[model samples]
Target: MKKIIFIICPFIGLYWLMSSCEDFLEVEAPNHIITSEVVFNNDETAIGALNGIYNQLYTSAFSSGWQDSVTALAGLSSDILEVIRSTNITLKEYDQNEINPNNTRNFNIWSSGYNIIYMTNSLLEGLANSNNVTDETRNRLEGEAKFIRAFTYFNLVNLYDDIPLLTSKDYRSNALAARNSSEEVYELIIRDLENSINLLGESYLDGERTRINNYTSMALLARVYLYRENWGYAESLSEKVIAQSGIYELLENLDEVFLANSKEAIWQISPAGRGTITSHTNEGSIFIINPIFASLSHFKLSTGFVNSFQEEDKRFQDWIRFHSGLSVYYPYKYKIRNSTESITEYSMVLRLAEQYLIRAEARVMQDNLIGAIDDIDKIRSRAGLELLAETNPGISKEALRETIMEERKRELFTEWGHRWMDLKRTGRAAELLGANNSLWQDTDILYPIPEEERMKNPNLTQNAGY
Candidate 1:
């Protein structure tokens, strides 16, 4: 796979606006201000800049084309079923025992994730030394930069355990840098986000929720902490975002959340103007079943994942749809594919519903039983179902944990690469995936650093068990 090139812009100079009094005539707007504060400053510039950030993630080499590859990865990890299960997919599966670091699946994710890291670092440096920038405005942008930086690092550390800790804009092979362990990489991710929470703003979709803000940072922090086993902080951060929520909410009609008309999103790449509508559909709908990948005809839900959902739950109504034979039991989360010209279609990244799940899981780990159940009830309540009553009083803590995991699966199916990651973290890879994969053991939790990177830089090395 070809490396996905990312355009990184650096901050140049400071823009100083001269001001006066009386008639307000002596003040002149420096052209530099336009570059820094006008085009790159203000709320709208932040939105446009973040738009580019979202575009980077949506690329096929990045997220869109990644679904199939993750299916393959999950096959290795045991999260998905082979679209063709007849002859014996389990017999010829490509587990890490047969993995080539140069394969399209591993390499594309590496390239795409690094590009995101590059863009985040560039933005952070620019914001730090920025001039003529209002403290309030600068704080918000810095908070945003920190959030993106943390997100990139979190994904990097999650997927690849040992990676070059490039906190600055260093791209040269000869540059002095060494691969950082997964624990260390996670530390940097945590520090950047902890600082961002105090600086970001609370944006609404009706307002400017498209850009990364305080709530978005908090959301990422919640997920990151959950990954790192810092349940206390994860629960705290997610609760803060959820409790302070105003515009963000769970769509009463679960189906609308993934549609263009979604009102529950806290952050989304608001689709506007026009862009390519793939055979997978476009506009606001995400097509899970299509003719392009006709092997999808035999798509089946994981029995565990299917049984996790409650009967009459609205999430099933919105996400799970079945028409007829051939291709049925299809996920209709993104059903807004349009012909002619694609107009507005929002790509959901962060939504309030997710915060509730995060809060629930983190609270469960924190041993806040009532709190965890409350959070879960919030999600269930939004689905038009009653809360966990006194008679049932919710499930056991361990059962609740599993239930939350399933709810997250049901809620976040086919969005970002959550399904695959969850399977690995939950230790279900070997069970659901069948046999043949020896690397799904404790050490094979993360992807090895690509051989191309190792060959290019002596400082970089592969992860353990590679």
Candidate 2:
């Protein structure tokens, strides 16, 4: 019996009829019209299936439901964000450290992430048995699918701790599987990333920033290593990416970092249309508030985060914007909220600045203080601030470690839940979050498994706090 599955299908009969050159369809094609045999046998159809995942990523309920992404959810759970004194229960719950298992945002992120993973697994299974595509296309497509799966699982493991690992589209197996240990999840993530690095080419596909390349996989691996405290491997991997100086450079202008086609971006999500005003799908649209369009300003930068930056830091000067009348500040890294005529920025997922921080943290863990300080300085100098050693000559390794952590807080705030995860990874979440919110407890680190998922799958277990 065919088990009921919920992922949106990206292949349609109309998809096969349309020219492959007609890029960026706004909606997913119906699932019934195409089968795995057809998608895997025809390169155009397979490409459509892959591109459909990207389209779904941009507008998927998980990515932008309630105009909230994991970034927002995680930020609110940390010290970097607070609700805008509004009656929005969801926003308040996250800020108050009172997440309900039934929270819509949590459900969307969990379901959406698994949905994308299932689609990728389906494509991978089809690709493995097919012979229609050329070797180059097969390798690229396989590598890309694995990369997406690894990325999705990375988010899942960190957020849920031990989630069911899905690598196939078999509903009987996938639907009833129990959560894998976090260590097991990491092992699978490492294996998938290793496969991705081996299979992906050095070149970006179709000259687009949206696709993950070989280095993109490496960058994410370095991050994974950092999180797992695999210092030597993480440092080496991050160094390899930083060595690609010709292809990737840290832009001197902070303003240009988030712009479309920015040199710093390793992977970004393309918006649905060309315009200065952000589409509703763009994550920036949720943060940007304008009377003309009346976009939601669900959360604001926490005073703790806003005041963390040094007075002379260029990020403080350029990337943080405030409304004088409202006396509230929002992240200005994504400059275009509404479109004027042409698209100006894409939602940045992976970038060079983070690689530096990853290497720095890894280096510090390995006792390579000099190398770590250099990496930190690269970000500092770019941010129009003095180098660490310059500012504090003969700073001890302990001091330098704290400095790097603070730099990450200042640089990566409001971007992703980098701050939230960073705190959790360093085992500082309880101290920091507890101080920020009296309601916070140590178990708050792991979000509860969504109530609906738990009810549907006997294997699912709720986190302790919830």
Candidate 3:
């Protein structure tokens, strides 16, 4: 009964998707819905409004969904992926359903990501209406809200370039919203993130383990810099995050990183108490855990990647998927899927491992090989592998760069749709994926605009090649 009210109260069952008031779409009415009394009419209510945004972390948009990561099941389905998988290079298992989508052709991730934007706008609108919020408090809340907006938009523009830019509240109908250029979107992202740097507080608490604070903000900025190819800023911000007096550490065993520990969690989205959705399948699991891809032994570890790890490395144990007495290097970072019954585990969004990675990459770009090696060595030490000497590595710089990136793929595989995105960003997707020229087309990089959005707005245009 309560759930029904919660759902219905937020919707007239109509997301008008219009320009006037449709820029934002939040499912929940602010506390003032029943009465014009502002929820932020007081300090407690204002705090709750802030917390509401944090709670969005557990939503299906960021949690267990095909868009989230289950698309790992599609490797076998794509002809392009098969070539890589047959060798130790690919471990795809969910090919049959990888490109599948709803009748609308939009994965739940499409809607979920937009919903986050809507909810964020709702919070921002609420803050604007509140009189009791002090300027100091208001700025902090505003900073965090903008951070989320930028973060969400970063994924949106990256996944669907030319996405509509909505900075206001007016979404109630299917209004026409022209797709903004990818470059423009990236500019706004950098601007928003930079503004957030000074606004968000130094500490925010949510029960115990996970919450966003100054460190989380810094970590996010580092990533944005790297994404924008700003090596100096990326390196500087990463160092600031690391020098925060050891706020995070690498988990002792590589396999244990996915088990919900927070010792080195710079920022993580916990999966406790999240709702369930039907999982879309993947290539590795279907091959190793299901019978559909039985013809080929489950995809084996790639030689390039395998040679990178030392025999003593602890993460190797986590990477190997043992089935029917055969052990292959599979994606070992996601541990919440073992249960056949429910998708009930926390999915980490940010961590110290990535911070170290960004720093290493930036250092290498800066020709600071010693610094880069030190960062990589710290990561290697945590994985129980022999650290590289600071003085000289036999490998060339390009090879070393590849080594650092591959480590990220190995360590963070199957989380946040990273495998696909990382490959695309690194320009390695074409070489790695099967023989399809379509894989490299700009249109395929971003999912096509939901057809309905195009139909509603006269100004809207389909991405080239869609």
Candidate 4:
């Protein structure tokens, strides 16, 4: 029960990336001094090691990096955010949907993702050898590490389709790792999430929602199942989370949903750097362009997305803000424009509203039209709109599925790459993006593997039409 002292050893992190294959996943060598005995002998050091992983998550190198993180790449690659036509080729590539194999943004995302996975493996390896930490502490730490590894891989596989699946800290295996099919990667993701659910406790490790708990694992697994079209599992998991009424509830006020302590948030990330409510590192600050700082914003909400929301929709009215005398509208969900006295909001990763949407989609596929409509209405009711039946009665199965997609667009826009990934998974990316984006093609759904990676690893094959 020693007081956890956070430690940073840069060389240990560097060791994981130093492989002869030049493959970003390579992490075969380490020159650091701390051994398993010192690093994981007690709960404090073990948890501190895990906190280091979360620190990596906060830094610009990972979640906060505008060029590489999903907050930007996924936003631009999809239709939600329109990038300013500027000289930044990386941003332009995603905006134009004409990315090349060598696009640095692709490289950044690939490398950063594996760096996190490698760190998680390191944590798992240390935890396995620890005898000083109590059994309860060990189980929780293992669960959190597994959850993080699974979440990182989920993002990688969704974007790259076929990717190297690395679970151990062995650099040789990592260097020689070949791309696994999407199916294989998904199986690993499911297995890890299931393991985490069994090991993690129901309560949050801390009062803040930044830490992953059993519900967080369940929420993510439900999303993975929905993506895989495992309707029964997805529906049941979504229902389990939804039943936690004492712990979670939909916010009546639209503006309150993104607050740091919002009842809606299942898991959130504390802002990096300045460590204030309005830290520039917060994704909210990046999305909200303050006039005092810049004359031109990085990006703005698309006209189509803006117009898609009904005039009466509460989200459109409250969550989106229009610049004076300009047609451009930016996401106003994260209200603090700059660093403030206290932190007011955390970057939201998973929430209760999405669970409702997940259940709705699962119900649609099972031909439970009434049940599906019921779930959709829960979201609509909170949005200050009438129920689905009141507006569009007796909707057919095909039409109801489409309705759920539209609901997702209005509810989840600009949050993550939800819109972009939604389109790809539903077989609608080509049809929807082709008509709107001149550069979009049917094959543009999967980004090409970084060219440098292919050159170093002869075993790695480039994605089609790179």
**lDDT top scorer:** 4
lDDT of 2: 0.77
User: What is the lDDT for 93 in model 3?
Assistant: 20
Instruction: Name the better of 1 and 4 by TM-score.
Output: 4
Q: Report the C-alpha lDDT of model 3 over 69-170, residue by residue, as the tens digit.
A: 323322222221232233322232223212322213244445556666765676677778878878887887778778888878877776666787777655
In candidate 1, what residue range of length 10 has the lowest lDDT sum?
15-24
* Cα TM-score per model: 0.77, 0.91, 0.76, 0.92
lDDT preference between candidates 1 and 2, better one: 2
Model 2 stretches astray by more than 4 angstroms: 1-33, 61-66, 273-281, 292-296
Worst 10 residues of 4 by lDDT: 11-20
lDDT per residue (tens digit) for residues 1-466 in model 1: 2222223233322211111011011222222323333445544454455556555555524343233334334433334332334443431233333455665556655655665665566556656655645677667667776777777667666667667677765444313357777778888888888788788656643465556667777888888877767888888888787776455667676656755535577666544312354422331232355446545443444445556677878777777665444434555666654444543346666778888888888888877878888888887777767677453475789988877886777777655557667766666655644354444455555666667655555666667667
lDDT of all predictions:
0.59, 0.77, 0.57, 0.80
Q: What lDDT score is found at residue 70 in candidate 2?
A: 76
- What does candidate 2's lDDT look like per residue over 14-128, in tens digits? 1121111011122244455446776667677677677777766765554542345778888888888888756899778888888899987777778778877877887898788
Q: Once model 4 is optimally superposed onto the true structure by TM-score, how far is the C-alpha of residue 383 displaced, in angstroms?
A: 0.9
On TM-score, the leading prediction is 4
Looking at candidate 4, what is the lDDT of residue 252? 94
Point out the higher-scoring one by lDDT: 2 or 3.
Answer: 2
lDDT of 4 at 309: 89
- Model 1 scores a TM of 0.77
lDDT of 1: 0.59
